[model samples]
Target: MDDDALRAWSVSVRYPGQPEPALADVSLSIGPQALTVALGPSGCGKTTLLNVLAGFVPPSQGRVTLAGAPITGPGADRAVVFQHDALLPWLDVRDNVAFALELQGVGRRERHARAEALLAEVGLAHAARQPVWTLSGGMRQRVGIARALASPSRALLMDEPFGALDAFTREQMQTLLLEVWRHSGRRIFLITHDIEEALFLATELVLMSPGPGRIVERIEPGFSRRWLAGEPVRALKSDPAFIALREHLLDTLARHRQANDKETA
Candidate 1:
């Protein structure tokens, strides 16, 4: 195991009174340069694994660590962005992003300046003074990303961050996220039920199964790095290799669902 990577070693999670574990013997490593994504159906424990990594939940077995340190509770080393933008409605864009810095006792001038730079990076500098509630879903999410960047987090952990947006807006956010990942250089660990989104954004994609959930497959699609290399998003997604892998993954998911149904029956 690489000491510098965020890792889950033989992790398992079983909720109280539950007959089956949410996750079983799952292991994964997220290195600095990889965009690690966990893709699965609703019961496949994607969020469970993410919560373990976030230190929001403890593993029933084994351990989760970041750069050799055990993750016992939530810490500043990881920032989470959720499906809905968890912005402070009262604080305008800039203030919301600066909120983290405020908690750390950053000076008024310094925090706002840092927040402004982050907003510009997300292409939202002009909206810094706008109320968060007045902004559209996608705009608010951009602010959320800016806020995450404001923290001194080493990794960005997102849970279905684009799931609430319309198709067009989701696509736009996907591109923006890739750009942010490139510039910020932070390790990304995102979970999603959207297959196409997973295929497009993951450098390392983990396919998970649901009966006492566990990893079924893992692959490095390399599409994200291609986008960073200046390839057009549409062209990359539509490539024959991309389409074939998408279909293969879809079939794998369907088979898992069938097996689970049979077990219940």
Candidate 2:
């Protein structure tokens, strides 16, 4: 799977009657083991770029490919976890995670075992028999993550998966997600408006700008690796290097916003 990479070349999206493209000349390559995060403000086409990558939205120009093949539409190769938990309300946590495996023709006993293991991985083992509606928001999102992982996909796509959670829950979820990523070693393309979240989770961070949304910067931060290497989360986050990079990103975002406002004015 060395050649298994998702690539977009000069991709642009234009909606009917829209004066500017939502995304313009955006090119990115997500390898088989990358945790890529796209960070930008609203209207910056972060979601647009993600949708295009997920094959939910087609680019008006250029093309997207996975392993050198053109992406025509959504496929089983990419599993998406939405901002809101997309769990089936009537299904129990175990069944919800096993649903995709069942659809793929896996036997009942095997699928159940796989689902149970995934639930445990996401800290939802105790909730396996619980009804979806009975789970808290964070629990529901854990179920969502488990479901996405149950797919035989090469890449996991997430759009603000923790955006709806409270601060404490969100941070907990981020830590859990990194643990999952470390274990799975699957490629990930995640979109988010949270700067700190992006910095914490991304192996490669892609910063985007509005006015026909395009990438402005690409950074590789070592915090995630440090966390994986037995560094405490709080200690790593409070490290001087981390704080400096965080402040720099904040300044860059401020400048982007000011430039956008002036353009509109």
Candidate 3:
């Protein structure tokens, strides 16, 4: 993992006619081949920060760069997995995965082949021909994951991609994500409200404050590569260290809220 992958230098953003910035003076860099998670409460600028990284809503001040080169607009080098499946109902699983390639005018044969391979990777091989309307919530999200993986992107940005799933499905998606992340080894920036999920997935955690956000904390769970490689994600989830870490972060958010309320009052 080389340095200078993604760096946001003193970035800040204010929506037109808004009194306060969505994000103010947030600075950090993500290296190549790492999974980073941003965790915060609602309206805490968590997604806004990701929008900056994904090149959607440019910051009013400062800029973001990739590989020492300034990042402008969106590029194919970055792929995003939004919470919504965003799959076309008319398209089958394979076709949905291949849609991007087809848009580039690739031959149907080659595109379908590539799509099948990605579907297989995500355990959706049998569902390749299934209508998206028939698939479950988790299945659709896996399709979204496959679609992102289908692209040869240098980085992956995910915004609470599992937020809508039931608890069981959410856990399953988390494990699947870890497997894909371990295999792809591409830089992943995941925005989430789940502290436990963030710890389980991210090599580094970025904690943000409430609205008009700034970096409140940065910590690494330091889960060993061996642990992440193992199948027992539940072990990590149940570990005392993990529980303590979760409590600490939740407490941190509570304190921020209390302080902010007092300041305003």
User: Each model's TM-score?
Assistant: 0.98, 0.97, 0.95
Q: Rate the local accuracy (lDDT) of all candidates.
A: 0.93, 0.91, 0.85
In model 3, where do residues sit more than 4 Å from their true spots?
1-4, 224-226
lDDT (10s digit) by residue, model 2, range 1-265: 4368899989999989989999999999999878999998888998888899899999999999999999999998899999887899888999999999998999999999999999999998899999898988999999999999999988899999999899899989989999999898888999888888888888899999999799989999868888889998889888898888889999998998898889999
Q: Which is the better candidate, 2 or 3, if ranked by lDDT?
A: 2
Clash counts per candidate, in order, are: 0, 0, 0
List of clashing residue pairs for candidate 3: none
Per-residue lDDT of 1-265 in model 1, one digit per residue for the tens? 5668999999999999999999999999999877999999888899999999999999999999999889999989999998777899899999999999998899999999999999999999999999888898889889999999999999999999988899999999999999999999999999999999999999999999998999999999999989889999999989999999999999998998898899999
Each candidate's root-mean-square deviation in Å? Answer: 0.8, 1.3, 1.6
- lDDT per residue as tens, model 3, 21-43: 88999997888867888998888
The prediction achieving the highest lDDT against the true structure is 1
Query: Which residue window of length 10 is worst by lDDT in model 2?
Result: 1-10
Name the TM-score of candidate 1: 0.98
| TM-score of structure candidate 3 | 0.95
- Estimate the overall C-alpha local distance difference test score of candidate 3: 0.85
Q: Which candidate's TM-score is highest?
A: 1
Considering TM-score, which of the candidate structures 1 and 2 is the better prediction for this target? 1
